[model samples]
Target: MMPNTTTLLISAGLLLARPISTLAQTTDPNVDNADTPFIQNIRPDRPGQTVTTNMLHPGQVQLETGILRFDPTDASWGTRRTLSSALLRVGFFNHIELRASQGYLHPLPGTSVFNEANPTVGPAGFTPLTVGAKFLASTNQDARSQVVLLTEMTLRTGDASFLNKAYEPAIRLLVSQQLGARYGLEANVGFRQRGFQAADTKLGQYLGTLALNGPLGGNFGFFTEAYTTWQRSTRFLPGLTSGLYWRPLPGLRLDVTAGQQFGNLGTGFTLGGGLSVRLPK
Candidate 1:
């Protein structure tokens, strides 16, 4: 099992800092000589809604984009489609990074765009802009484990009819552990407050995720995950997703995933793929 990074890092950082801080208070010339070389940190998003606990090195940039994403609509209109940048990450110093995302919506109404049960129900628009920050609290290369925290704000700047027109915010804590050279485990827990108006803020969703990922061979990998949610009226909703990923060259990855909800209220399936590229600082 991989080491628990958040726990270890908090400990290690304190130990690493005590001496340095003590030296800083002195006139020691060697205090400035503690430059540790950096090892490569590579983590990509896509193929799952659960983000991983990894951060780019300072000055690095990563693009996570979807070529085409589609979901079967219960409505007779057809499948909803989109082409979008799911996320972009840029690393600065102090184990922090900037993130941005937007998706173009093209909803194909099965019979009508409005939910027949409730004419008041509609869909989100072509463009939903989300901006966030990701912080790496800890990483342990020897143990191959990491921990990360991410927070995002969804801006209601898209087509008003397609959006909730309210600011939605979310936060997630991610943990990853490498079981072996061929196997790994990850888990996530998060909360999102969505569709709130002015002072009516409430917990809209409670999320839990777990996954097992392993390599298929060189440059090829696969992962299967179960994502669960607890909501107000629906109570509990469960979903499963699986995908394969390939790397044809260094710093580039491609992935395809399909997901479906499971329950009496379950409806259609979702299919999407993503491409990611990393650029060095």
Candidate 2:
């Protein structure tokens, strides 16, 4: 005997209702109030907002020194080099900051051919100086989100005998979001225009970065970041960085980072550290 279609439909309906009945039993009444300010305050929609304002005050000064190495895999095309550098940065106001850096770049002797038919090999050295600024467009207090607009210009002001003097102007937009009381995420996207003799021949570069930071223990915090740059060459250079920051006082901090570079023009690892001091209003 064939089963009745009406009876079969009723049986299927009961089977679907069982899951709904179980869900209703497991649901908590407190879950409905989960959107309270107490919860939202701890997990702000933006980073650098929940933290006390004194953490990043105006009239701050920071200093950093480190070593960077660039090793080209194709020795015939480029060279391996190291740079020792120092950076000094100052915050004039809540919205503006200035930075200056200088470094000695030493290139290891390598084989290269200006003309593929003729091979040339030599050692080279140069000093590079770079100055830049970062501007904050929207502060953490803003209703929308934390947004920063940054513009920087790096110029090689030292002797150009070994390296061509050049200038790079870059603009970036940065935004951050707070995940929890101690965790935050940030991202930046930028475009750089190169200036100098070969500037006309090469296209500007595009840069993108993402980072995460959070308090670790007592007064220390951890940070990690990944960045990539796209230039005229089809190949892209990428870098990864990990760092820790220590805050001894309300407006002072020390940070150290280590990372490696990867791609056609970048090779090897880098270690760096910096100190920042912020003044009260």
Q: What are the models' TM-scores?
A: 0.73, 0.62
Alpha-carbon shift of residue 256 in model 1 (angstroms): 1.4
What lDDT does the true structure give each of the candidates?
Answer: 0.69, 0.58
Q: Taking the tens digit of each residue's C-alpha lDDT, what string does model 1 give over 77-195?
A: 24465545568889878888899988765544443454546454445455668899988877432235668888999987765545346678989998887654446688999888866
Q: Which one is best on TM-score? A: 1
For candidate 1, the TM-score is 0.73
Clashing pairs in 1: 75-110, 76-110, 76-111, 77-109, 77-110, 105-126
lDDT of 1: 0.69
Pairs in clash, predicted candidate 2: none
lDDT of 2 by residue, 12-35 (tens): 999989998878755632343224
Model 1 weakest 10-residue run by lDDT = 32-41
User: Candidate 2: where is the Cα deviation over 4 Å?
Assistant: 1-57, 69-81, 106-126, 139-144, 196-202, 273-281
